[model samples]
Target: MWIVLLLPIVAYIFIQIAFCRVKSQSKYLRNVPGKRPFLIFGNLLDFLPGSIVFLDNLMGYLKTYGDTILFHDGSFSWILLSIDYEFNEFLYSSSVHIEKSDQYQFFHGWFGQGLLTSSGSTWRNHRKVITHSFHFSILLQFIDVFDSVGDNLVKKLESEAGKDSVEISQLISLYALDVICEAAMGVKIQALEAGNSEYVKSIKEMCNIVVDRVFSFISPRLYKLTWTYYREKTALKVRGFVLA
Candidate 1:
């Protein structure tokens, strides 16, 4: 009983100590726009209760903070979020800013060292190899695949036309998946017709897990302690098995 009682006090003390150490380093970013951060927790408390509202809450922040905002995690590691056109243009156009953020590691397990997760010379090489695939002439060949997918999408949407409300995002996603599978791999998975397949189910679940991880206040290294981590790994295995 005594040990359990003391645990909270001990944890609080440690967090305060850690926060003090990092506070000076992050002081410069305090002037930036966004919600005022709390000790140790930063802006993480705002995301609690339901992480499923992450996207909606992010939109709210954009409205409150304009284009550029600053946020930090529990560890007081500050990150600048920007949707300003000039800032994005500069970041993407500059060769010096080729490196991606550490948060991208969350995708490493599923995407491997593919273009999205790779950087530096590896990214350059991957981009060069795939550059021709997106050429106008090459993309023109996929028109039939797009038309077929669009037809399937229209048929699916027609089924939902009279409903009081319709969630079209998932429908569009399935259409894109079908098109990609058929055009890229020559495999007609018919994702729109069979969106509940284990592979597609796993893809959706894995995507949610990734988004949750990004918004989570806990450290990614500690994810092994949670059931969601195992679920994500299982989803990855399912996806890999289906792809193979």
Candidate 2:
């Protein structure tokens, strides 16, 4: 009796997989040669976890294949990826395609309607206003800010000179972050001196959380079910820092 019951369930699983495989191959995308997708998983099984490896996987795929490749997530959504530099440059710079990708809207919760995520006229208006800030004369004002951050970094490196080689990547990243905060935000965070800042910790956490959601097989909104409490907590911390 146990064998009889298990046989039907096993058969059902195979049937579902077959159905999903068939459905995954779209009429338009069928022309592109790529990996076969699985039910509710798509090509997710083929990717390494986290944002960094996920991007590497794409570049690897592009290298293995040609410029155009088909990619899918779960059952419903499909992406026609293009690696051709000229084609992508035209797509990005063309006035007609001003809207950011669907994934960008997820960042709206953290960044608000600023340049990277905003769309339509709001983005155009912000672009116009912020473009002037990049003028040569205006940018010349930030030289002092760069010098200040660079001087502190040199002093920090000199202090650690005789010791074993330090990870300059993190140290320089912290310094660059401090420069951006001072120059762009007009706030002197002095993040290098602060060492472990609550804002820095929270923002880093927020970025990782966002990257996970972006690559998730399911909808990004679904992350709220698991991370709502944590998301709110971090958002409050970021808002507190910005508001202050």
Cα RMSD for predicted model 2: 5.8
User: In model 1, which residue pairs have backbone atoms overlapping below 3 Å?
Assistant: none
lDDT per residue for candidate 1 within 37-128, as digits (tens), equals: 78657777666545677678778888999899887755556678899999989988776678886678888878888788878999889988
Best by the TM-score measure: 1
Off by over 4 Å in 1: 1-31, 49-56, 241-243
What's the number of clashes in each of the models? 0, 0
Each model's C-alpha lDDT? Answer: 0.81, 0.75
Candidate 2 lDDT, tens digit per residue, 6-85? 99999899668756665664765788866666765777666645545777788877888789887765535566688789
Alpha-carbon lDDT of model 2: 0.75
Candidate 1, residue 184: the lDDT equals 88
- TM-score of each candidate structure, all chains considered together: 0.83, 0.75
